[model samples]
Target: MSEEALEYYKAAEISELQDGKVHSREVDGELICLIKLDQEIVAFTDNCTHISGPLNQGEFDGCSITCPWHGARFDVRTGKVLRGPARQDLYTYTVKVEGETILVGLPPA
Candidate 1:
């Protein structure tokens, strides 16, 4: 890892999150959501665009996440707000892999 890259949290692993499961993690004080959809890895912000609800507790479809509080849906790969009440998209981080570990890059400070 480069000197500057060390400041952020890298992808830990290719985690196996079951179908309909929501995983929330905090990286550098930023809340992230890791969702496993149809055997694919998708990441997004854990905060809802509407009412700031906990998206980590939301329901997961193939590539869509439904917010628990207001039932807002978003696309994980593109962070696009699918169904609303919410018009703002969630922030996305880049992901990489190092050996058996998955690496995700955080925005530069």
Candidate 2:
């Protein structure tokens, strides 16, 4: 995992996130979803694997998120695909929260 190149960017603020919900944020012009799992913050691409559904609008029950478009389910913590129509797992980002800011690391362009 450390072999991949990454560039960390400021993704969101703590005030913009809430528990039991997913937040879609535009970081460096790319859409990413921020979620809280077991008191830790994690991030993933906002686009769902099944037909590119907007995952931020989906139902998040604190652990798993259900896609609103095709009912695909995903574990918010590991970005694992739980149920399908979506055979591919969502892409996760390395996240580090500093004070009130959330930083997400993405591959360099």
Q: Pick the candidate with the highest lDDT.
A: 2
| Model 2, residue 103: C-alpha shift (Å) | 0.4
Model 2 Cα lDDT, one tens digit per residue, 1-109? 5625788899888877777678888988889999866568988889999999999899888588888999999988788999999999988889988988889988877
Once fitted onto the true fold, the runs of candidate 1 whose alpha carbons sit more than 4 angstroms away are 1-8, 15-20
Q: For candidate 2, which ten residues in a row score worst on lDDT?
A: 1-10
Give each model a TM-score.
0.80, 0.90
Residue-level lDDT for 35 in candidate 1: 64
lDDT of each: 0.75, 0.86
Inter-residue clash pairs, candidate 2: none
